[model samples]
Target chain A: MAGEPVATSAAPVQPGAVLLRPPTNPVDRRAVGWWTVNLLIGFAVPVVVLVVLGLLITPARFWLFTPAVVIAFAGLAAVLALPRWWFRVHRWEVTDTAVYTRTGRFWQEWRVAPLSRIQTVDTRRGPLEQRFGLATVVVTTASAKGAVTMPGLARDVAEEIAERLTVTTQAIPGDAT
Target chain B: MNGDWRRLDKRAVPVAAVTMVGVAFLAGVPSAIGLSGISVGVALAWVLPGAVVVIAAGAGAAWLDWRFTRYQVGAERVEVRSGVLIRNRRSLQRDRIRTVDVTADPLQRVFGVVTVRIGTGEHSKGGTVQLRPVARATGDELRRVLLARVSTSVPADGRLATFDLGWIRYAPLSFLAPALGAAAVGGLFNVADWFGRVEGLVGWAIDLLAGLGLIGAIAVLVAVTLLIGTIGALGFWIEMWWAYRLDREAGGTLRVRRGLFTTRSISVEEERLRGVDVVEALGTRLAGAARVDAVATGLPTTVEDNKADQRTLLPAVPRALADRVAADVLREEVSPTAAVVLSPHPIAARGRRVRWALATVLAGELPLIVLGVLLTEVLLHVAWITAALALPIALVLAVDAYRSLGHGRVGGYLVTRSGTIRRSTVALQRRGIIGWTVRQSAFQRRAGLATVWATTAAGAGAYAIRDVGAETGLAAADAAVPGLLTPFLAPLPDSRPVTDETVAESTAAGEA
Candidate 1:
């Protein structure tokens, strides 16, 4: 927690200074649904196989086993639904000093890397991310792999963030920081 | 240079052909037996087709080599243009070349031809620009021009004495008993067969020796095994001894020529070498000898049987001359101070030891557990017990993060010594460090420890100092020379930041 994000009061905007705005397009809800569906399929297929095997072995206990199978599938479905709410709470911030990303609700996960420490920045888009017009920017430093996904952002916004981070990080005196 | 670099021994192709045909015949014999069920004549007929295919493939390879192989070295570059169908021409710049190695097999020697291998560092995509079966004199001239152009260091004035291994010095002390025992065992086996032929004479002798005979037979077998192992080890030592040769030429390049049947020569620029390692094998240590190898970058991978990629850059030198060679040829300060350091937490050693112990225990217990389950008819219960037992071993390994690692500065160099069985000690100059990092694992965060690794571009070997105290490691890396290489300058006592005047003066001196 020694390197956690410190609260900063917003600075007054200078008249001639260029002010950058955070992207407004939210991460795609469809991508989240697709991921949830895949997770449920994985859980359900195995459970169905086990139920079929149990029924073949013990036909008289079918009533008892069917309820157990239904309960297990319902529990799995609830777990898959919770991540949608979790993703909504996650946010990413990029400033002059550092790049920060926070995810999760009950157990928060935050990673901050100073601008001077950034080694290389890479922009990657998966098939799902491409469909949603979102990209994940990964910043590799000497210390660790730090990344922030700007989901649902316009294509132009993602490109601008990647270019600006690259230029600023390269200008820093000590590459290792 | 000669453009007429012709084909190697023509006999080699035929020898290769015969070997291929032999293999084909063996393979077809099995299939011929299988086809016999269909018809006896059909099975015999299948062998003819297999023979034809094998002969064609072998002849094709030989014909391609005979048609395509040609290499020529001019003043600027060495060109290897080969391939029968699609001609490939690869030329390497002499200036960019690092080292030239010449090797001669028995066949190549007979033909007065040798293979010249030109090595360029990591960037060279192709295998060593090979000049197959070149004249020995031309090979020598090529080596001379390449070495002159590539090496910028000061060379040694005189040749160093060659190292020799004495038979008495290398022979193991346990040789006699084993040799005698082998002879005795052979005699016993022969004696049993002879007993029937000479029943009256042998039976009388056997009855006299019956009481102590079994004990003598066991002793003989043990002795024979020991002798064979010692003889094998002695043969290796003798080969290593005969191959060792060191050449110190005028300039800072140290050329080492070694190997018995297939000789290999390696050149290392003094400034480029990071360190020299002196390794003592258990057998060598008993013999009061050690093998020394210099750590350098860009050594060619020695391929045996054209299969495994077991390449190493460590060059072996005799122990008696190690210190003097390290001082003279390498031109680096040798410190007597032992820079070896252990991990901060004993956990580093425990991690390796525990894994080995767990593997041994599991291997020993697995069969017993399976047998017990089969006997009791409770396989599922046994499997659960096995899973539960694995949990503690997994936890032990996870918690056993590397610790107690230490490194220190020695004169103008930094030395890091670590590892248990395969102990590695790397020493490199401060100016050589390219970059470094201080990393903390999730578990290390809870334990308040970090590992620091430094990267240097000097040699093939990368120097690393691991699991040192977090703050100390960071400070050590920072205090060493900066990674951004400007030009080297003489230290100015005045604390003014380096100016253009100082840069110009340093460049002038470097030019001079």
Candidate 2:
């Protein structure tokens, strides 16, 4: 809400002695709905191919369908459940000094990129994400891992984060030069 | 100041001719032996004449190549003009120069000549220029001139270290010795098979061993293989490191000059160095020896460049001596990594390694177990034997891996040690670390542990302080590169501001 620059400012004070500030904003809720549809379509093509092959190549080995069906259903269940769980666990916070990401449910990873090391900040919108009015912010660093992507944000919010990150990174002095 | 255009040493032509003839003979002899109807004497009658022609042609080509290639050393840049058909002219700026490496193979060594490679540190194509078969003194002079800032005498006293004959003992201890021996054996077998001599050779070997018992035959086979491996390893070590010397030139360049047959003189400018890595292979570690590699930008990371000895600061030496060499290179009293008492990682890390090791060993046994239950009793005995051997080995390795995980700071550098098989202790500059990645799996979260990676532009790019307490990992990372991770962290319930004092205290307490 405040237009004051966070760059060069001290870290946001600890809220009730908590060491880390929880993710400041939630992504667009429609992200889960769009992801579920996308995953189902992605999984369906492979499952269909396997079923057709099983019937055509070895009709006597029809029992192959049992494991295939079980696996396909298991994968579908995970895909269906993951987006919602991801939406819940995935959080990002940008400070003057670094950009932080906390993502993955079963495997929680926290990544921090110092502003000085950032090479570029970008906002990407896939067809599926566009349909849901969502976008992803990707940060490129000097390190070989290339870039880190944070998906599931409103298009405008993604643009705003990208712009702010770019400005902050450029403002920092020393290191790369 | 433009210098006169100079050609390669005159002896290169004859050397080239001899090499061509030798190569032709090596190739022709093998095929001559393989040809079913041709006698050795008959084959040589025709092959020798062809070989003479090859030698003559090779000499003629070398002469033309020498005539076409002329290089001029200028005040500001080095200019090389070469190619008969293409007629290309290339110039490298003196200020942009990063390395000047000299190489001399056995033939070149006989003629007292070396090949000089001038590198500008660019990894892209056309970033290096080569001047072949220069007199060894000329190569040295060129190196001195190119490396010098304002033309000062480089003191011979600047030499920090030289090759030790005792270091040869470490040669066979390296994993490469046995691996190379195995490859050599495989290659011999392959060649024999190709020439249809495999059966004959095996039959001979079998006949020789028939006099001995089966157990004696097996023991003799192993002994023979080991003997061959050790000899190969010793020969290789002598060839690669015979005249090894590390020197700090007056102009602040650190250069390595070594080799027996293919002698190499490689140098890296001091400014490019960001840190050093002290690597101890499992066997070398057990022998209390280690090697030092430089962590620097613009030194090639490409696989081919590794064979060129791009980053080796010191070859295998006593761990203490390697540390001293590292410190000498950095101009520090003691290398930061070796000096610090690195904090041990959480017990959860050990638990994780043990679990993974057990699973891996079990997975290997699972196939044998299933096959045994379904079909054969012999396979069941094999499975039992395999499990009995593998499980203990896996446990020991897991414990070694756990013991290797530690991280600490010494002044301006952050030091982390990890790995069991190729254990590395990297002392990287704090300023060089550009980012941090704090990771926690569900299992790690349950145990309140995390792996924090410090990402930099140098070395393997990311070195991790694995599986420490979540808070400790963050604090160490934050302290290493101050004001980097603090702003991004979510406030914790028991949050205390991670100041330098607290970080120092935590490290002193061994991150316990």
Candidate 3:
């Protein structure tokens, strides 16, 4: 249930105004916090299983344990530290005519999608996201890359964005085919 | 019109029998080898019963298939009902039929019938209906009636183009030659292994190679492999394109009839023709030859589908001739691909490619260099040789890729070309472009360039004009598909001072 369409921060102002950077709205601070929780549990389960198997099966006990301990620490460090950088790079904007998303840390990818080509807008909430009161909006175009997903938005915000994208996309003219 | 269901040609039975017999013979080979000690007459007698049983069973199934399998060409749809145990009934809406292709393997040639495949242009498995072994005349008539609306504007049926025997010289230039040759070698080993003698063969070959010494063995191996590859390529070329002829039929359809052992007559509706793609592989480009593929919606894209949708219009012709053919296929005076000189991408694009090439080479060779230093003297020799050869090759390809990046507009089409290994220049109808995607990486942002992708519903679905100036890329996209992207473009920061008049005019235009 959305009211009126609100232009994201990336919307152009007067005809001559410069609006190059995407919207600066960061995801809920809880997203980074949640990812850290998810990361720890995700890594812990697999690492515990692997260590148990290594101790039971392999003869080179020290060799296996050394890498395992090192990997655990490194993984923990990445989970704790990398999300801050990810939070910085991750940005999304929805204009009247298109959707722009800039994300990824090491491989920063900026994608632009003309609203006309968008075939579907899906709002997803997994168990973790639901727990954190967050949702992801996926904009699927006719292109082969499948879709562009912007994660770490409030559930209500994602649903509203999906609704608006659907309305505006439907408003665009049809293709020749 | 036959509203009732009909069966395939009666000749399919004998062809089925013959195929079954051939299969039986192949299956019996190992047993025949085991029976080498027995008398020839005994061996023949032993194998005859099994072959007879297979042929009899196959012939019986073929007869049953002919009886139960039926097709009906109706007013609004063409329906095919098939299968023995599990029934399959597929129907294509008459209006949705995009291609009607007829193919006849060597055995079917003697029987005077062909398999008809009616395609709906959808690349999915369910998009086509195969009518196996129909009378040749019926296939032709079906094709004509199915595509009646397509050729209403054409005055008369005429020949458009035909294969030249001279084109065979370009066969070896294709990557298929070495690829097929390697496959053939691998196949030989596989077949030999089936007889349990692969170990002996490999040992013998290794002994021979060892006698020759490493360098001489390498040289000999390369020479022999190349010889086989070239000959295989030439043979395959003759088999596939021996009597190739392209004709504009009385109705609005372009028909390409080709092949020697297995004949194919594929037709594409004129109404479905959107644009053309000119392809130039590194070897073929070096030889001044190119191929052309059709860009049309509903046409199959899977490699396994009708030999990749049978989209090729001209296979490996002289680049000049291919361009002429591309224009003729589109029924235009000048090929849209040839009418304009493409705009070259920025120097930064070249730098990006060169860095990528070097990175790829380093990724591949680094492990070998490390292993050589740490492990053995033999590996050390290999590492040095690899570096000496790979470095120059990588540099050449990077430069070639940079040279390949270009985009242009010709007539009502937007053309984009790129790639060094498999260069493709697609002339997409400007009207067909449904959307534009502008991408700028952090590095590309610094370099002041962007990749512009024109999205469509046909061909590869999208064609990218890579690494052009950001402003130029956006302007080109807007110009190609007027007004689609203009509303979203953020105005330039410097525009207010430098081009006030133009800015005011653009603002007024935007308001309008």
Candidate 4:
């Protein structure tokens, strides 16, 4: 007896598929600027402290601490700068069976979660983000602390993603895992 | 229902008047004391100002009583129309009420008057609609009507149970022995002087008592300890008796009625409950009694004021009944959730243990150090050895954290157990999480660790699992909710936008 064709209706979305693009609004640009400003402001305190120490301490001790301070600042700046590039490079695809995210510059990190496992989708905006009309969407899964944040999206885009995710997640059975 | 609602007992008026007078008298006591330390004219000045304010306040209270003393309750609602000139009218809807509390002070009891308070979940200037000094019979009828209305609104599937504390459940004798010993030692310091005062008349009697056989002394000591314990137990029993009723009504409404002089009742809807916490205090743990509290959303904000209301639920219950009662009242499968073990990182847990042990060693050696300084001797050597002894205690604590550090899931719920002397076990469902965060510090990043905090709308803040491996934490978050990582991955389709008319219609429907 011949076996029947395997069902492909619930197959995972293709990794290279582009589901949708974020809204091209001035608000999105402002949100990026606001985050940049916050990062700069946070850096100011350490900079002030180091300057004061350099002025008060001896030259030899100052030189000893200066490299460590510069390294620390550079590390912080790198973490802050990486988000912009990550957002630009990131793309998502969704099908009946799975949701996948592909993001990277030199080395890519691709995460594919079956729609059955999708639990909740939440969107939030701080005061600065609100002023810039941008939102951050967070998707949480079953595993502890298993979440990813997507920022710099317009308000309407965030709402649409929330609706689609809710529908797709609800339609799948055995997704609670 | 149409029967007359009698006014508060007339004698309550006199008792209130006496209380007011006493307050006024006490208000002047400090000024009167100050008067004796100053010149005659200055003393008069100090006394006059306070006396004037007290007199004015008393007169104003009396005027308020004369104008708006009477309050009435009907089958549908309670009305308290009071105020001298402004005429403040407050009406409480009987259907909106969650519980009715009736209390009576010693004087009010004698006068056959009761203070009736009707509590509702309405948010306004008047948190509780209160009518003080109503007649005992009227108070009872009012309570019945309010309870009847509230009971109708509750769903039919809930259960009602009453609990009592017996003498056996009284805390074990071991817990109070230390306190009694301390009290007796302190009492010895005062007894010698008392014996001296009556030396001539009862000198022989006092000597006989002091010279009593060791057995007699032991018997007397045992009697005193038992008496104190009995008194404490009686107080606890009385409180338990007064606040013992629990009502589980249909539609998932759970009502807990409790309190002594000021009876407080709380009604919680089933859908709003987030979790239940079973806490055992160090003393209670020794006695094998654990207190249980059901956690819910929209808990009264007043519960946060630790001083005024420490209880998030009713009084503490025995451990045996905690799980059973939670299941019966909440109608949810109750089990142990996650176990919150202390972080076992050497730098964090072991470091704290080392510090504690060192402090203990220092404490033990402090007296010798002081004596050495005074005697100019070699007790300093002993202090050095005492410091070394702390190492073992640090090692023990670090080992304990490692052994105790474990967590697991029970069915669909999570149970977290932690603490050494005072242990806590919290049980919560997976869907109860309102939100969560995964945070990493520079140090934690280097160590491949992160802190995951899950927030619910239940208590004042969030519940957290700290310093877990970053990969494990991420996995746990995914298990908690899969798609929470990217809520806005795909853009939303354009639709008919929200308008003023739609907003108005929704608001109108919500109000209805």
Candidate 5:
């Protein structure tokens, strides 16, 4: 679609019923490995900067190692359990009518968006995701806050999901708002 | 295709120069006063060179900017180019276009021109292209052509609402009065400080109030500030809403036109309007008045420009009138926010509010109390006195807020009301709710309370029912949009008795 992605008139909506339950499908297990690496890098950078500064400047020694040790402990704990915990928490499922997603580790969030409201569907692959041969599918609705991201799917699976969503969305009418 | 570039209206230079000069005069008052010390001839001689440089630079820059600024609607994208030495170009994809709005201020109206803004409805500033001060006919033609696909020519009735001189009664009731008063005082203090005379001004004020005791002086000061605020608020309201009118155009658009010195006409395509927000600030609520705001998708975001409230359709008026207007805007028999029987949040929500309020007060009090003990007895006294004064007010507000918390639905709308200081009751079309976000923090989980947000592309982006009982939030969300949540919820087929059209209305009919 270019220049003018003409939206057809609003088709009647089939008012479907929804229940409040956790999502059904868990993402690829490779996501766990990806998270572990991603988290380790996130924690290591700050500690590295502190250690370098601590060695270079005598004055920084008073505060550097203490923070470095704390970060190290936190990083160690995160690297060990966070991946598995997130893998268990992050789940999603796409149906003919809507998309259901559960994200966030501690403060749980459950989101459900009807397909009629979906504006766009695309697959994103960062370098890290490419390294793991995994891709993430991003679905955006008209609402600024209504973007759902499901990470850690096999690259091919992510592409298929995005393709299916886009096809389904195109058939529905209105501005997908 | 790359089309021929178009320059902004030449009048843009005069507009920019006038505004810049006004700002310069306001900012240069202190320097102007300092210049008074010198003889007029000497001051003129000293200021001539600097003034010449500044005026020339400012005029030359404005002219160059106006000359360089160009906008074009190409085959696939709309682009704008501007700037002098630091040239900049921005473009928005045509396919991504979500809104094309035309607005004309009094200045532009005088020149028979308007501002055309095209956007992708994204939150980022770059998602939009603003073509300021284009010919009025061109702006209208652009809006018509850009949105031609969706236009439906339904012969509209006359105005939905018109400005009444009586509405000014509610003007003084706006909470902006006290806030504006305080802001004025703050400005005065800043101005005094600029002259290094803040202490002297404070001394003079103290001297003036010496006749009264400490409590009397404070009461007098507060009363005076509120009085000033009321006048300022009234003047501002009149200036902003002097000739307000809400109308539905023949081309399936709901248009709002208002403002005195600076007039604005903002139109929302009826198709994009998902709902209405009925706002009643504490003052207005107590006075039995409310304002109506259109909850339409793709309106310009206010975060980038703190200036126009493009969503407001009606100013503070009688609640009944606001409801009537809300109904008219939605094409409903009666507003859902009015007809629905709202279910109040659990009593625990009340307790939570009280606890949060007192906790906040204690946080401030404890720090002061500790500092006072370490520093002086006077501070300790002041801390306890402040706590004593604040506690009851906080508790009352918390209780009122708890009472205000409610959610309900009527017809095809989900009506939810929350907030105390600015209580807003929103009647969002059930179909407009494209998504749901259910959140439960650990403490909220313990309380069996959850916050459910009906996320849509309209007004606030998401309207939330806060601190509702867990089942209440779930049932509301589930009932609001039937099948989407079924797989996630436990198999409670009869969770809620078949209410409304949930099961019966399997037909695919869009909005009424």
Candidate 6:
């Protein structure tokens, strides 16, 4: 909060189109490590299977070897670069009135959902995320596509955010539609 | 509650049993002929006794079901209790009920009973309750009670639109006509197979084709198909909309009652209506005809296979009339779909479309070319010929799709028009939009384009403005819903002092 310029709902809202700012906070540092490990595991299984088939099947060895080599290189590149790339890209911010998030690697999306329209807030901790001491928070509005997900946060931070969202959403008045 | 519990009509037992017998009889015809081809003794012995046993079993089941099934219209809720092996209780809050639909098939009509389907605004399994084969009077009473809250002194006759036989002209112009025609041909072959005369039928068709020259045979076949298709389309239209009536009742419910053999009365509460979708498929569009569908919330599907949705307020009428009726439904002076000045997509959108169209052609051609190289000289010729013929058609379609892309704000609705073959212009309530999703692909980023989708709770969930200019997309979203996107937005960097002027609305157009 000291270094980041946290937006306050009390700020006067101007009426015209303005450049949508990035969210203030980055996810936990351990999340990058978690993603790298997961990416390695994800890319390893396919390469292993291809290599096994290549070894067993003599006629298709050439075809399977090419794919296995290609996959291994692709996986290596993604593991080395993508997790760090996404760590810089993905950010989330919550003000009294709205929750804003910036996400996606090649195709970015910045979503803003008003607190008054939020219907439910939930926090989840998967096994890997738990190992990394991280959690994901999801806020859904009545609209089908209006789900705001902020993943790779410290567990306590995710819970606190969820709690704040729930309290604020309840305090605001609307059918959430 | 016990004293108020009412059993379904007693006569429903016979109706159900008889309906089963009728279905068996109709279905048995083909099987019987096929069986008799093997052995007359086998056919006679099996179908007769099988049918009798089925009738007895159906009667027993129907009787037991009737005896156990009871419904109660309580003060706060409506409950139905049924099932033999495992008793079940289903109830819906009276206040939550959004629609009360009454339908009667030919058999049920004869028995003076109708199936009452109660629906909520949710698309969940428990969102509907069915009271099968209730007395017609009971069904009507339930509908009146469930839908009509207060009987005001002002009786809103509520009749907004009625069936026009002249609209039958548009029947043959629908995309359904050709499909129905092809289906009829398939159905004939199926029937022939059932009768073990498929070979004979094929021989007859070949003889007819052979007698005519090649061109003549093709022409004759096309003519026959068109004739059958036209007749099928007309018949289907009649069956679906013979006595169609759209009325706005005094209690603020829009009631649509239609169908010939199977009568249906579907009521929609006005409060749930978000907007309307005016559809114009290519065939109908060329003929100056269009259909209007209620873009309301809670257009729920019941357990019955009503795959054909129940949203049509006016089916393929004059464009002028359709627009007027859509306006009427939305309680607006002019329909936003027609009235709005839609901002067309940029010239780059056309380029994008052309590139996509060519890519599509290449995708198809690649497989053909590969096969042609691997197989024979004939396939090579075929591949090149197909490429030559398909290229122009694909380009034309792509150009049409480009022309169809537009979005606008008019009245209280945000209107979006898209698609070439089936161009639909949806006028959704601006307030109904709960959120906006702005998307840009890597290619789109290079082209300075973005697709912005307005997400809502009603009707298809989201409507997108495809390939809009990046700044324009953000500006539109920002303007449409004031303050929703304001806090997140930052003014353009060091350009100039801006008023209400739209500006590259990028605060964090990050490395992504």
Worst 10 residues of 5 chain A by lDDT: A1-10
lDDT winner? 6
Decreasing TM-score order of the candidates? 6, 5, 3, 2, 1, 4
Mark the regions of model 3 whose C-alpha exceeds 4 Å error after superposition: A1-41, A51-71, A74-78, A81-145, A148-176, B37-68, B154-157, B183-221, B306-309, B440-446, B492-512
Residue B432 in model 5: lDDT: 89
lDDT of 4 by residue, B223-336 (tens): 766666556655544653464677765545566666565454455655556677666655565566666676655344443223113234444456666666655654545435
TM-score of each: 0.57, 0.80, 0.82, 0.53, 0.86, 0.89
Candidate 6 local Cα displacement, residue B195, angstroms:
3.2
lDDT of 5: 0.80
Give the lowest summed-lDDT range of ten residues in model 6 chain B: B497-506
- lDDT by residue for model 3 over B1-512, one digit each (tens)? 44777888888899899999889989777676667567767777778788889999999999989988889998888998888899999998888898888888999988888999888866457888888889989988888888785647685457777879999999998888888778777887888887788998888888989978888988887777777889999999898998998888766678888999999988877767778999998888999999898887766665667544388877889999999988888888989998978999878788899999889888888888888888987887887788789989999999999999999988899999999999999999887776665666656665656688887767777789998766567678878987666554556443332122323333343344
What would the TM-score be for candidate 1 when compared with the true structure? 0.57
Give model 5's docking category.
acceptable
Candidate 3 chain B weakest lDDT stretch, 10 residues: B494-503
lDDT per residue as tens, model 6, B1-512? 22399998888778878977987798777778879978988997879888888888888888999999999998889999999989999999887888898999888999999999888766568888899879999899999888765444435656788999999999999878888888999999988887678999988988979978988998898889888999999999998888998998886688889999989988877877888889998888989999998877666744463523577778889999999988888888988888999998766678889999999999998987888889877888988899899999899989999999998898789888888888889999988888777777766765656788887877666788898866667777877887787776666442231211222222222211
User: What are the Cα lDDT values of the candidates?
Assistant: 0.53, 0.78, 0.78, 0.54, 0.80, 0.81
Interface RMSD of 4: 17.9
What's the i-RMS of each model? 19.2, 9.2, 11.0, 17.9, 13.6, 9.5
Candidate 3 TM-score restricted to chain A: 0.79
User: Number of clashes in every candidate structure?
Assistant: 15, 11, 3, 48, 15, 1
